[model samples]
Target: MRADNSQHIVEAARRRSEYTRSKAVQALRALDAAGEPVTFETVAKQAGVSRSWLYAQPDLRAEIEQLRAVQRRAPRSSVPARQRASDASLRRRLETANERIQRLTDENRQLRAHLAGALGEQRAARSHTSPRGAASMHEGVDIADPVQPQQPIREREQ
Candidate 1:
């Protein structure tokens, strides 16, 4: 009786093992149909089997490894291609911007120098003129005014 009971238990265990293996195959098929990568983890999860069980199946293990390798390599090879294009475009834009900034800086310096020279000439003209005649070229507009040096508001406040 004990022998018969042990035999029955062994048969039940075998059936469960087969069921698990069948589920693993179904999982791989579902993944293929959905265009999903058949990695060990995904197959294990979908089949409700342990990773160890998937690895134990030599054919399935080999197939999963191949797919995983392809998935890994495909992305890495394409990334460098994309990065090269973007990097070159960015480098060109940066150089153009720097050149424009340099040109603007030079123009700004020239304008500042011209303004300083004009201001100096205006002061010299005012100093050379007598107080009675110390009026702007637009003398008709200064009927009730006098020519004088302007001081900053900060100095007046002080």
Candidate 2:
């Protein structure tokens, strides 16, 4: 139009694109160095750019993909390999737990048997001490004696 500043505008746009690309690269490196996951969204956020823009750059896209692939292949656990528990150790722990459970089960069975015997003895003693006509609280009838028929009542002669 008046001064033909299209060339200047193009140069400015090229510089801005280069600046944005540099920021993205720096962000990617920072993330990698910090052991943080490198992805388009993270880089975009770190660099204050759009994910679409990062994808549009072939070099940046390739780098991000490569890093992501590496991360996927790497173990996700926080524990170091050397510090992790071995199979033998885990097996031993399981065996110990099973043994303890078995011991507890046996103890509980013994305790229940002892309690049943004590209660039976107590009930028998109570039945022997109670009056002949009195009913036992447990069975609603005397355990020591069998049921007896009552004699018929006869009217007295006047």
Candidate 3:
């Protein structure tokens, strides 16, 4: 009688083992069909088994390692497009700002040179004038000759 009970228990355990193995295999096939990475956690979760079970199973553990290796060797060239576009925009804006700054700097230098030349000419004219007229000439406002006031060099150029 005891032998009969022992055989029954052994048979039941074997059936349970076969069911677990079948579940793991089915999960692995589904993952492969979906082109998903077959890791221990993924397989265990899909198969409704514990992670320890997968780790303890030599075949499953080896398969998971092989899949992980394949994942590492796979080519991944998926960069975020928005980030690339933003970087390009930042570069263009920086170039434009630099160009504007260079133009303004050149304009400032030209204006300074023109101011120096005008001052030099005024000094030479003062040297040829009488002292009485020279003192009055330095004033920007022409009190006596307001009818025909002096025009600036920029306006004369136009």
**Leading candidate by lDDT:** 2
Measured with C-alpha atoms, the lDDT of residue 112 in candidate 1 is 100
| Top model number, TM-score | 2
How many angstroms is residue 152 displaced in model 1 relative to the true structure, after the best TM-score fit?
86
Q: What tens-digit string does per-residue lDDT give for candidate 2 at 51-155?
A: 999999999999999888867777454433335578899999999999999999999999999999998898788768866545355544334344654232232
Error of 3 at 21 (Å): 0.6
Q: How many residue pairs clash in each candidate?
A: 0, 0, 0
Per-model RMSD to reference: 13.5, 12.5, 15.4
lDDT value, candidate 3, whole model: 0.74
Backbone collision tally, model 2: 0
Better of 1 and 2 by lDDT: 2
Model 1 C-alpha lDDT per residue in residues 53-145, reported as the tens digit of each score: 899999989877876675566643323221334667889999999999999999999999999999789757865783635544333243313
Worst 10 residues of 2 by lDDT: 149-158
lDDT of prediction 2:
0.80
Q: Rank the candidates by lDDT, best first.
A: 2, 3, 1
Model 3 bad stretches (over 4 Å):
1-3, 75-158
lDDT of 2 at 98: 100
Candidate 1 displacement at residue 63 in angstroms: 1.5
